[model samples]
Target: MKNIRDSHFKLHTTSPSYPILASTELGILHAKDHGEWHSINAFNLSQKLRDFIKNNTEIFEIDDVFFKSGLYFSDPNKVWIKCNLLTGKELREILCDKYGIYLSRYTKKHILINFHFGVTEECLDTLISALSQIEKNTLSRNFSLNENELSEYFVIPYPPGVPFIFPGQKISKNDINNIKKHQDEKNILIYIKEVI
Candidate 1:
């Protein structure tokens, strides 16, 4: 089980976003109520995550059911995997019986290195300081504004609701690839953070 603790996550969700998702800095658990997505520090985990996603595409793509594998992390030991069918026991049975996946009735948590979505140390400080004065639910959009500039901090729907670029973070080539992967998805909204 991953240790859940209060964290100083860099970005905060504003009015345009859901309050529940505001302070993503906090550690995450894989509880059903929290949905299948878990928050991991996405640092070294991004490559691992991409590999896991590629490897398990068949497992996840069953019956029109595919899930994003990039969510939970309080303890990196707890690898996050999501199958669209959480309510079904078949998933557990198949994983355990056929693929030798460990089975657990309880949701797992992951403890990961705190990453400011690739933000550098100095920028993280700026975000934290700015976050202190900002209204609880108010968000300052920054970096990029539209789908064209996806590398800049854009908030997507929860399942994969992160990867926003903080002030000091430069857009990596991988960031461009991630955005390009979903370029056709009209629903992905990328907001430009209004830096202080």
Candidate 2:
């Protein structure tokens, strides 16, 4: 049962080794916006992305990146590294305007997780305990999840395209039977990769 749920949590048509990601391998993909941090270097963009990921662990990947030119340089420095990370649909729309990118496919509407990145057994156990207690109302809206909410759901937190919680992967049988128990009330908007 856990295995089945795990499978449901993953991206469709993927396997243990070959996971999907939001970013594509478009070498030298030019930034639609640019600043002092980086000019026209893919390596620099990738590194900046890595740094962003290090800070924001919940983001899955940048759907696309563009360079922004002619922005004020701050005291430290000014660089426009525009990329998409999985996030609330509303935020994505707002960011699209800030970055000058139209709201299109880059919007994020689901919570994504990766299998790698040190999600230990103990961490998973703690998460499960927390998730079971979240009320449907609390899960609604954009709010920081409490220990209970964060712990209840275990996200892989990398390789943004692939899924950590998928169908077929075993999960707590109680959770499986009582899908409504968890607070992800907007489950219809959420996408998990798996084969039923």
Candidate 3:
């Protein structure tokens, strides 16, 4: 075990794995016993949410956006919704502030919703109601990016920290469109040419 630990630390430059605590191990065992029920419930809720979003594509501007899931099977714990209308941060803020439904922001374009074991149908109804209310709200306009002028700046999106268009990299029309589509107020685009 010592040799294995030494080898792991040497290879990764990090501490070796630690054993699970007694309470955590027992919790894992308990979760294993009830995992299937939780999974099924989560799956059902996710399906319902998906259906709601699909039916309201006009309101949500979700025609281009899609859920990260297979045709028939999907992981029940979390659902990744790619939203074209709103940034993950914007969606997170709206859901949390107005409806009290907090969500994880996976990226500028993607929002992650988790359905846990204790989540109920009433919770789902609340979320649906919140979404309906949001439809009546107006979305803020975004600044347009000119394709020719893009060469003057490096454009990057945070919360999935990566550059959409970087300095010295050739920017195409499609790239500009995609960047404009995904760019949100929460994640500010840094203009690095002046800084450089």
Candidate 4:
């Protein structure tokens, strides 16, 4: 069932692959190899919408996403919902007019995984000037993670949908290579804690 407690996706058509997400109308095209499914939202709440949520009891969720569930993004205004059945207008009418909800259309976000640059004075100054991120010069404090390891339901935020570190899991390694290997990529940065 959808997080709304009484709503879900129903496929009106079939696909050569994942048959559950094949809908020409919704642009729910396909799935990734790791069972990470993605789709282009056909309906935006900013625009008028149609009643796409059927009056049935069939509940089908595509793993880590739901039609009307809230996701983390540091702000409520950045909350997004992916479509399975309900249209933007239908969602607004049902959830907003009736139940008082404020769900925005899918806001494409660039989520980084297992990486965070320290918020230092220099970093702030660079941000004020809008310069590129500061470099990591300290080698003794670097950390790394196993790209192919994670818990079944580890601490993860949506958008990038990557797993955050959790206790009791061997998802991390003592080597800093995994993180440094991707540092040159867009917005990928890691901070090494300092010792007193």
Candidate 5:
């Protein structure tokens, strides 16, 4: 039984022994000593951020921006904010360039903010202030391609790293519709020959 368990563990594990040992030790320390405290703090901070954003929708100028986890259970470690007017790339660039705060782009229209154990109220305040100062900038115009016209362009969704339409590949009406739907949802970036 012991040998079987050992063989199974080795087969399932990918990391080398030394690093895995160190990581396991750290995980144990965190879980045993600081898990509850960190959980509570992260939960409160995430809630505060959600509340701030919700209350200041005028500042954001977008309704239903934040992605809700559920009514009863929510992940307090990360929050996803939807970008209606600006793409996620644009929003991330603006936040990094202007506010010196970097955010993860979850999709073309969604930016992810992560809450760490060390996150403070002041950090949240700075984020709120930066978000309030953001104004919509004009997006560059791209030639719209219809279902029949999609063969010339390459459409890729960044977050999931999937290509919807590859250049020179024939796309069916359904595939074209899916691409258009994703684009309309601000969930993809379409690349054209001229633009590239």
Candidate 6:
């Protein structure tokens, strides 16, 4: 199974005004809870998250599910995010000055790099290419991780509930079955890969 820890990711919160999203996309809002009309499929969910991070000023409250963060991180209206302890100051500055968004008051304790990359091959490439282009002088690279190490855990998209996993941790058999059941019933897909 994929090392759940290696798959841990933080999402970028963006403003609803980002220009990257088309009027049609902006109008294509899904209820916080995916209904019968649309399901929180893995591909689309990651894409929306990537778009929000690359183009808008958004914030998220931490969510806890799957015994990951426990219930402490779950907040429907709020998103809890973790940044590299070292990059906290700079990230705070970028979000505030560049995006004009305020971070939550909660303290960040880890260096978790939330690579909110999409599950599709194309989106994954886009994310990697963008990461390569970031100039070290212009941006802090504290959150950077070895590219080769990224495949250790696959990014899972479980919406309404934050994506959950940690490297080296085994996915409970029950969770696996539940995920599969959700896929069969709601057309939702949870990405998984063995932890190298």
Question: Among these predicted structures, which one has the highest lDDT?
Answer: 5
* TM-scores for the candidates: 0.21, 0.23, 0.48, 0.17, 0.49, 0.24
Tell me model 4's lDDT, rounded to 2 decimals.
0.29
The clash numbers for all candidates, in the given order, read 18, 40, 0, 0, 0, 23
Ranking by lDDT: 5, 3, 6, 1, 2, 4
Task: List, residue by residue over 144-174, the lDDT tens digit for candidate 5.
Answer: 6565554776666545756667777766788
Query: What range of 10 consecutive residues in model 1 has the weakest lDDT sum?
Result: 106-115
Ranking by TM-score: 5, 3, 6, 2, 1, 4
Please write out the lDDT profile of model 3 over residues 103-191, one tens digit for every residue.
75557766777788778889989988887776545332344456665465556554464666766666688877677666544544443
Per-residue lDDT of 1-196 in model 4, one digit per residue for the tens?
Answer: 3532322334333433343332532342323332131112211211111111122111111122324536633321122333223333553444445444333432222111111122233332332222111111221223444555642223322224353445345555532343444443433332312110
Off by over 4 Å in 4: 1-79, 104-196
Error of 3 at 136 (Å): 1.9
For all predictions, the C-alpha RMSD in Å is: 23.6, 23.5, 14.2, 22.9, 14.4, 22.3
lDDT of each: 0.37, 0.34, 0.64, 0.29, 0.66, 0.38
Best by TM-score: 5
- Give candidate 2's TM-score: 0.23
Cα misplacement distance, residue 136 of candidate 1 (Å): 45
**Pairs with steric clashes in candidate 4:** none
What's the CA error at residue 174 for candidate 4, in Å?
A: 63
Estimate, for each residue in 11-82, the C-alpha lDDT of model 6 and write its tens digit: 244544334444434455543334332333443544454454445321221222322364455322222343
Per-residue alpha-carbon lDDT of model 1 for 1-196, expressed as tens digits? 1222232233343433334553442434333334323233334444344354455332222122234556833433233443331223544454456444434542321111133344344533443333232212122222243333433343342236454555445667665555555554533433433321
- Higher-ranked by lDDT: 1 or 2: 1
